[model samples]
Target: MAAIIKPWEGTFPPFRMYGNLYFVGTQPASVHIVDTGEGLCMLDTGYQHSLYIVLDNMYRMGLNPHDVKLILLTHGHIDHFGAARALRELTGAKIALGAADREYATGELDLSYAKELDMTYTETFDPDILLSDGDEITLGNTTFTAIATPGHTPGAMSYVFPVTDGEKTFVAGLHGGMGINTMCREFLDAYGLSYDCRDKFQAAMDRLKEIHVDIFLGNHMQHNDTAGKYKAIGAGNQYACVVPGEWIEYAEWAKQNMLQMVERENQR
Candidate 1:
């Protein structure tokens, strides 16, 4: 289990990943802001304790938190949606989460995986919008299509959308929850959760491989080497995150990793 004694310790400098898509999250969790012509669409608010850092990062980047019209969560984990209630109160942004993760967000179940991080989820709130597969959330100039990618937490949702750079457009896909920590046999047995989630995870990964993603976004910084790519950006590669083939490769690896884990458990 990962213990985060100080959520604020993982602060990172925010920057723009593409045109209107900006990376405003911290070093631990990845948060993004889409400057839709109408308003801002925030993807994944990090830990509640670190919300002030996110807000500060947005202000430093000249992005106003009050302009946030939508808070689209990738999952219902505390590290991802822990600050949703506070953010909504501050900006009145409508919170949207996967339909299956509704209870997770509402604190009805202690399934936000907060215990894994040695924390408690005390900032839960009812989501304004419960998302399903193929649901398209349209803001001013952007439309995010939600793809149900359960397993990580049952209602983990991947999203695909078009990112424009004024002169050109590219498709970006954010994998909802790829971590198999919760899907492991011991974890499942401890929680009395079904083993079927492993099957769903494999299927979800396979289906994601079919989509064409120009840019791959990760909910966690390490998944896509956010730091390394940011360094490459400083070295003058403005489009460092736009590698077309990386998404498919990562998707395949994620599937294989899970399979290997299950294999190891079965062997034991």
Candidate 2:
């Protein structure tokens, strides 16, 4: 909690993961771009302080900020949606967030976990689209289905969509949030949040395990070894991010990790 986040210090070079999807975020947080042919669909906007870097990354990737038609957030956390308002204003992109996490974005509930990360959430705005489970967000040639995956947050959501590389199409999945900071006993008891989110988190992981994801997208760079894959792509592996078995492995690991934390807390 004492960590001071210097958003600018975490800039990473942007590159295309596969097909029309591109990575344009920093080391601390991950941002993705979906070139839907008609307009761009931005996955999560990183911290507000690092917005300029994200924009610069977009330009570096040959993407137009003005053509961003949608800013779809994976959850309500500040690190994920901190730059939403400013970005929407700049691109006129409609901001879409999970329905359960609406209050986190609007500042109605001081639970964006900003303070926990040693930051403050100042850019709050109403989401143009309040997505629910099974909701579909369509733009141009791409459509993403929203799946409710709570536990990380009450409104955490995972998106599944199809991406194409001209001749072949691959299914891509972006998991919302998996950090245990909010679900851990210390954090829950301190914030007066329920412990039920742990159960929800475990269930969400199980549910996600059943889904077929060819390309697993991580909200943070470490979750997917984005840097390693980026280098691999540079070395001529065009489909470096595609690992159909990764989804199940990550989901199981996340579920077991949560269970272990709870067990440790009980022992304490």
Candidate 3:
């Protein structure tokens, strides 16, 4: 991952992940908190002092005393789950996530993160929870299905949050790296455009369509950052790559992009 990436730090509506995971990064970065009324679940906790930032957000947003029933890490990346252990201490929440990621988090399994890979690991640790694909986790009247989508990391997983707003049923795709972010921009660039790499990513991303995502959200807020991390980047001349709307657009985009790449690879 791009180590130079800034932690989540800023204000509200300031950042919204794929319009699915609503959150704003702060100065020191904040915990990516998702609260469905009394139900609260953190997709991923950020770096040091970041947990408190989320706690602070809870107060500001009137979402504190948040029933953080569970902490679901999208993967074992340092930035993604560095503060997870702390949340268990602060919120007393149950941790449920991917089994493969659990291996990487606990240090039982270790993979060297290279520049091309856009990840740097000084250390690796084990996760408390080892979840498998098709496992459904319930927290505060809500249930999130674990769908293993490994590409960024051997064990990368995305959580499908079941949220109902009025008459609309929202299925949120909570991935650690669902879309382009500060980390992936550099990582994708560093990795270059090799047919092998493209093929692999295409294969990995092909699994995205297998699941239903009405709202696409990654661990980070910005969909893509051609500029500063927080700046929205999608649209004409826009360096940011996100627009607030239904998550279906994101789901379609991911599938179409993967297919497009696969088609190009076949053409070549």
For each candidate in turn, the TM-score is 0.97, 0.97, 0.65
Sliding window of 10 residues with minimal summed lDDT for model 1: 1-10
Residue 186, model 1, lDDT: 82
Compared with the true structure, what per-residue lDDT tens digits does model 2 show for residues 1-268? 1112666678899999999999999998899999999999999998898889999999999999999999889999988999999988888899999999999999999999898776789899999999999999899999999999999999999999999999999999999789887898888988899999999999999999999999999989999899999999999999899988897899888899899999899899
Tally clashing residue pairs in candidate 2. Answer: 0
Count of steric clashes across candidates, in order: 0, 0, 22
> For residues 106-180, what per-residue lDDT tens digits would candidate 1 score against the true structure?
989888989888788999899999999999999999999999999898899999999988988999989999998
lDDT of 3 at 196: 41
Candidate 1 residue pairs that clash: none
What is the Cα-based TM-score of model 1?
Answer: 0.97
Question: Residue-wise lDDT of candidate 3 within 12-43, one digit each (tens)?
Answer: 33343332244544432234556555577777
Whole-model Cα lDDT per candidate?
Answer: 0.91, 0.91, 0.54
Flag regions of model 2 displaced more than 4 Å. Answer: 1-4
How high is the lDDT of residue 154 in model 1? 88
